[model samples]
Target: MTYRVKDMPACKGCPFYQTGEQGFVPDEINTGAKLAIIAQNPGELEELDGRPLIGRSGQMVIASLGTYGIKREDASWLNVLKCRWQNENILPREENILRGAVDHCTGAYLRQNLARIRPNLYVPMGDLALHWLTGRENIGHWRGSVFIADSGPIRGSKVLPTIHPAAIFRQPAWRSASKSDFSRIARELPKREPVVTYSDVFHLGVSAEEFINTIAALKGPVVLDIETKSTRPKSERKPIEETLAVIGIGWGKDVAANYVCDAALDEVLRAIESADVDWIAGGAFDFTVLTHYGVKFKWERCHDLILLHSRFDIELPHSIEFIASMWTDRAYWKHLTDTDLLLYNALDCAAEWEAWYRLAAFCKARAPLVWKVYMEDRPLIEVQVALHLAGMPTERGRIQAEKRWYEKERETAEKALLAAFGSTQGSATAVPVCATHKRYTGKSPLKARKGEAEVCSTCAAVRRSYIDSQPLNLRSRPQMIRKLRESGIRVPLTREGKTSLAKGVVSKLLKKYNDPRLAQLLNYWSKSTAVSRYFKEAWISPATGRIHSVYSMHSAKHRWSCQKPNMQQTKRPEKVLESLGDIVETAE
Candidate 1:
């Protein structure tokens, strides 16, 4: 039967929103459905349209299910999280602050819903889902495994973990993860008959025959995992497959083309998973997502990244960002703490985990809390601790001695920013790219049209200009994207529309991230000397026409970040910030 969310009695006129004409409460399956997918939350479009998987990420999800036997219209999806992940797109602090409430509702729904659906295969789409499944909030240990925890609905069925579909949308390279995922579905897919036709251009880079051959050649039991987002808050779980990006790329990594915050990270991740010849964070999330993407593996003897370290009496990291940035540059979470190192080569991808484990070992010695958390019960706590440990010792005597090093880093960073200002003394803040000028002129060098992605020259040149204009002082990518979006212009898109990677113009325009530019003017349309160092395009801010850069005081701790100035955030800028004042090059 077709289902629209039934507005639960508690949600009627929730203080957070203005109630509109009431709709059905999100259905807690009383019966009839065989398989249920638990996820994070509904996107704005889904809430407004009264449809699941119809939102930007949902579209890709609904389409992906077609590849298997599932259909949003046919099979039921129960989100572990509910509500519009409001304003996070603009003001993340507000979103982060509001997350506490979101988490409450999610727990209530799952506590009640799991008792309802009781499907044989409890598919938690991402790490969040798995958090509740394994009864542990720590992602390091839970990322790639299936366990019978006395929590959630996994008690009643085989918990099959698959990559979130959002990953494929964000990182096409993650198609490798999807291949095996589909194969898993194909195995369990009811043989009655195919009821749906999923129209997806994405495919496994290698055929199933080749995959099987590769697995045989390797000749050993493989590690496997199922990454699922929790139904309790953390709305990223809404699209089940988006979680796979965590598996492919290091969890929390977003160094791909465009970053929609979810799927965009998934594509680059797929690249990492397929490239892992020896150890790529050595976990099951990778194997499981690969399973869905048409790749297959035997998981009789799987090992966990945390287990390996724990065996060595090591502490686990809070997030992949710590290991990646602190340890492995090619690792996904590297952006959480370090500068952009676009891991464009296969060798870099292979070395990622080496860096990650190396840092994990190093940081274990310097962990701030000096406590131990089991992967079984500490996913969230571990992430927190890892970030804390990954922080560098600030450049100060007393503070370093007192271990108040973060303050020293802040002071140093501030001084650097001031010095950069001095270097640019009176260089009429190169006007932020105006829409008309950008359209007619050229784009950035990072986005310079190459091969078939067929980016626009104007867009490419403008991207280059932004690269040239960045002041020498910035911290990470989060700061960059935040400032760019605040400055009032379109953020670039990865081919996947995930991060503002400035790739395929056709892809971003075709999917989400569609900005209605007024002949290229943002609504606020104010001007600024400096925008967030995150993008090659212009982002809009509150009607002030002024660019605002919001800083998360603790954006980096345990590791490096792909975030710009928040520079290491993800989808590295078209050009490095170090070269900002240089003149633009003519490419078009």
Candidate 2:
């Protein structure tokens, strides 16, 4: 049975009614909304207008929803407390009063309304409503997060908590975060097709001769995929001596073939080479790996799915599994076996072909300019592959010497710090009592006389004198904070009030402050971080006597990324280039 507010009588003795104000019932209460929005309470304007949300807060909601192609009428609006009490003193403050009202309203009205509407999603806004709905205290922790409502009439429905529009109006800082949350909701709400499971394509596995014949018969573009033993380059401790495992090829939807990449390798390579256009998910990685295995092909006609999809939606995940989930209805293969692996690879090729057609159509219809840019950037994928194949040479002696120098410099800095602050009580390291540390002792070091309290050795005045100081430890958060404080800069924080020390944040901070010490520290930190992260003993290729990193063109920005001794992020670019001059000449 459908329920409406007119069928039930209003409470008479409630504070909202006693205040000589009329009770409000939303006009579209029984409109059967698929999405429900639960708010804290009604404002004075809402009470007068006889609607749940018609105030400034409602306008914000309307505007945010409009950005994502949703109208205000698309969702049902309800409040945690049904009654409107403008006076703060008359509002329900005691737990018993609030709980009683919630119990009465939920049992009498909310349950029946929910049963009639059966909303797929519930969005709870503000502290009171969000907490009462989810039983969580910290609204900040729950905001912008999706959770399953376990109890009440909204059980089994997705609950996305967000800050109230009223809060955003009061605190402008929350505007961006609220908009981001709304954007995420929009992405998650789009309808999708049912997932496609394993098909009958595996039964079409062909012999080497059959594969050659099948490829020669194909008239259109072919989707290609290769399964390898390891995606990483050959390292000293764990070298990937054998690369290719299975070669999967798809010529249209149902017609697909896979061959064990042992005896039939040459025939498969010949078939791939003969194809007019080869579509690969990560073309750079695959092409470079094939080059290493003594199979070279001109990558002029290669259409990289990674680059194409990145051009369309840079933020979406570009992994084959993720892209398949987004574009196609394919269910990801769960089992891990040789046969399953081959089938997975084959299905990926099929999905790639389908995804390409969809993206091509989308670009042609909506964004012709973007399509042109993608085509122009297509040849650069081959250039990236070439760079990866030409492994960078390293001077082991110079690397060792630089490492030693940094170690000595760090030790000297630590000794100086110890002399400035004195050793910590019963501890090996010296810790200064700065402004932040003084909070623990309830003292202000800045208010204290000179030399009375332990002053920060890296204060603004002192740091300016040592403007060319290099960072000894790049990974140390405390050290980075000290450096920022000494340079009279505020640390960047996220919306949730946590420190944001990302590279972009640091880069902006350096540009704003323009302090030589901070600039030098950042440069040294970048180089030191690259050296420590990538230039390790296990990363060296024993067979080649040079570091060979696995490169992929499937990055979000269509740029190359190197893994396992990342040569793309060298410590000193000029030094490494000079050392690799002979190798570069040979490669050229």
Candidate 3:
């Protein structure tokens, strides 16, 4: 069925639209089907085909469904906007126009379409569809999470969001994640709506006596988590500063207890140190922060959910929100107000506690060896905390000097680049091999072709002329391909058919062509970036007076990865290292 402009009477006079009829793509509905799929709008092919979900994106969704035993005809398909939002060139329209179109269409069509179909389950593809359903964005965080609405056109329907198949073209990594979401949707279709029964037994703002009494009486394993005051302005002076604000503890399946970190602190610590196993999500962070503040507890009594979950399902996110969404019916609370910090913290503990048990039982039943491996590796959490405390000692003066040196190098590089490329203030006299004659920005150096004596002119435009008759952005893949081809070098294309200028591709090009200009271009591009990284990294932690890098044993290969200034990839300055104390190596 073709939807015409006449059908959407309200959209006829909208200023946002430039084209007519070619934009409208009608929905393909399987009436009374249990499932429905929604995308933001029609792509070029989708609009031309005059049907939703017939393009590449639809094909990917269908292919994914095939792996899960779901047929293409099993679900209805629709889009938020019946019309295409892009202009004649296929570029997105102005932001205001885009927003206006979405507002008008969703209000005039999407809601009504959803209400008309009224499927039991809805799979909202990508961020726009997600925002329409839940008023939230960032598909990365929300994907694979089940959201049940109680009030919109989608009310009473369970919506599972997944990244759009088109996202794989730009972010190849999300390909696996997109497939995982479809798997989840398939698994959820047959099951009843996940009923989240968060323990209503929340004890907030209890008295000191009550806090101690609760901690003392706790039996069996408990989930522990803490809320800290972010030392923001003060953080500039003290990078690793964190003050304990609230402690959330969960013992019973339906109970959560939170205490203000006040007068009864010592009693709470001693009690926790002596209690049964404490399940914690991201225990390395919590433990390190507590130890930084001089609070000590038994590491043997703690189980890190991050490590355990990664052992079996490393591909999936192990965040409390992601975990809760998978195992429990806990609503995504990260977006909710944090004014009630204790309540939020308590709920987190509750979710962590619930997810921990669910994940453990799953590992035990399906992958007993994984469960055993986690138990064996659990002791390493203690060693990691100790290493965090034993930070690398640095000579303060030498560290300051090192920073100054990088700053000086950046200044010198900038001056040299400015001298090499004429300021972006003039017209090019001639075009270079790159084909486009464009204005030159004195920001970076453009390497001269072979045998062209490295010209050191105040105006880099002399060399820029040889590159393009029209001004060209060297950073652009198309422009680079043209430039390489002009130089008799055949540029390779990515699997997506775009020009491949990836590091590996460029490296291969350099070896095959052995062009000195290519080598100079690579070095010039990386030089400033390498110098700039000195400021971005977490160089030193004031609390430890040393470099305390975070090491993790969670990867596809199970190889150890270090972050927060990845020490594995970095090398300390010789002078700085000479001034440092002996390394405190932890036993693997």
Candidate 4:
């Protein structure tokens, strides 16, 4: 079954044939091998050697197999495009030409090869090779999961698409993810599609009594989730309750019941509260919103999958979709939110239930102490949920007064700076000198280390003058950098020589420089930024005139993150206390 150039007349008409490159790299077909590794196209070395997967990337793939005790000779190797698509200059051809080449070559060689050397496992590296094998793109979403293809050259084979080794070379963070995929491949789990049996009991004429009874009958650990019309309650004089669109409750692995919110609201709440142990994905919103509907639960009985996931990998995303991708065999269905609401919610409950056990087991086995700490801190979700709903009472009049005062201060600083140095009306190029007396180049390293380049004083003043003449806002990175430079403040650069203006950098610069203009600029920037941010975060409830900000315990390690009105970043706590003096009468 060796594919020779003379045996392939179809390749002569391929888009890559015009490049006059070396002959097609023949597939290293190992008949009866359980695994087949497919790559996008032949690299220069692969093409010259007239063999598929002979380059560095191919070796990395082979080494991953070796980690699982699978030798190189045990798996067949292939390339979607047999010949190299790039020319001698290493420049890829036009988009249409590349697509045409991939289409032509995959059909000509890959399919026939698969038929002869049928593999139980198919590993497609990169998107092009993945699309050829499974007719799917975006390897990021498809990778690390075994996909059972319905129809393709490698149909019915367990296809595991992973990040290309070349991609891992560019982004080293992907290496860990690639290793996870390799580990899954080594396990060689059976190919079985994930299934969830969902019943719309409310719409199907099932009584509310039956729904509650079903939930009560289930063994401990019920997963609860709710879809709502609005994330928060609409504050009004009469206390507007949060509207629930659908309530999803699932027990065990396969059964999930989705009930539309109507007369069954009380029953839905009862079913949720009756469960001895409940599993939820970020239950902060679900529990908080339920409180508005007069539903309360024993917080100790609840488990948040998001918090459980953080124990395993704190930095990785802890969303239900991300967790499910790792633990459950379910396909990606979050996109179905637009088309089918009930089914999407049902799928979410099923994913939550399934991912919870796997995540719990993984944490218990690998990091028992971490799991213990997570369990101890798990009850803190209740505290956070309560704090969010309780909210901070603030005077609308005081907020407006502070905002106006900051705006006036910003105007005063802007005027002083402009008056001292005349507005830059004409073009003036900045001969920006680095802080260490080095020349500024686009390729300069961002770090302000011993040899790294940074913004200079002269360039900073000149840039400030130009920005002062125009509208002022820190909306864009370039504008913010221009402002920072003009103020005679040293702005840090990233490795790619791009502006790195994080809050920490700004704070450090403010303390490092004592120049009057730098002080003025800081005053202007701080006031302007605070005023804008305050207004944006100021979503005060009309009924209580309080900010019900969302809070999270898992976003940061051993710390909480607040959003909406971020109370943590409040600059003047003394001022806030003084404002609340009237509410709390002073005792003599």
Compose the digit string of candidate 3's lDDT tens values, residues 241-326. 56777877876555788888897777776665665555464557777766676656767777887888778777766667766666
TM, every model: 0.36, 0.54, 0.76, 0.67
Cα lDDT listed for each candidate: 0.39, 0.60, 0.67, 0.68
Residue 332's lDDT in candidate 1: 28
**Model 4 pairs in collision:** 446-493, 446-494, 460-485, 460-486, 464-486
- Clashes in model 2: which pairs? 196-329
For candidate 4, lDDT tens digit of each residue in 1-588?
223343467787787775343456778899878788888776756755777777898889889888989888888988887765322313253788877877788788777888897666788888888877777868877787776786766677677788789888777757767887888777763333322223322222235676667777777677888777755443321112357777777665556877777776786786676665554655577777776777787887778888777767776666676677788766667767778888888777777887887778777998798799888988997897788678888777666655555667667877876564445432345545545434334222222221225545554554444444555443354665665566566788878876777656666776787556545655666666666675557777876678777777776576888766666644643555565454344220
* Steric collisions counted per model: 142, 1, 19, 5
lDDT of 3 at 247: 74
Please give the range of 10 consecutive residues that has the lowest summed lDDT in model 4.
Answer: 443-452
- The better-scoring model by lDDT among 1 and 3 is 3
Winning candidate number (TM-score)? 3
Q: Candidates ranked by lDDT, best first?
A: 4, 3, 2, 1
Q: Write the per-residue lDDT of candidate 2 for residues 1-588, one digit (tens) a residue.
A: 222233346544333333233344542463756567888776656655667777788888878888989887888888766654432213455677667666666555555666666565677887777666766555554565555666655666677777888776557756755876677567545422111233555534557887777777776667777777865543432222347877777665555677776687776787677665555544556666666666566566677777777777665556554454445444334233455776677776776766666667788789987688788888877676666666567555555555454545445555554343333311122234445333222111222221225544434223333332333344566556654665478888889877866767778887887755555555555655555665553244556656555566556566667676665555454545565555555443
How well is each residue in 13-34 modelled by candidate 1, as lDDT tens digits?
3333323222222534537555
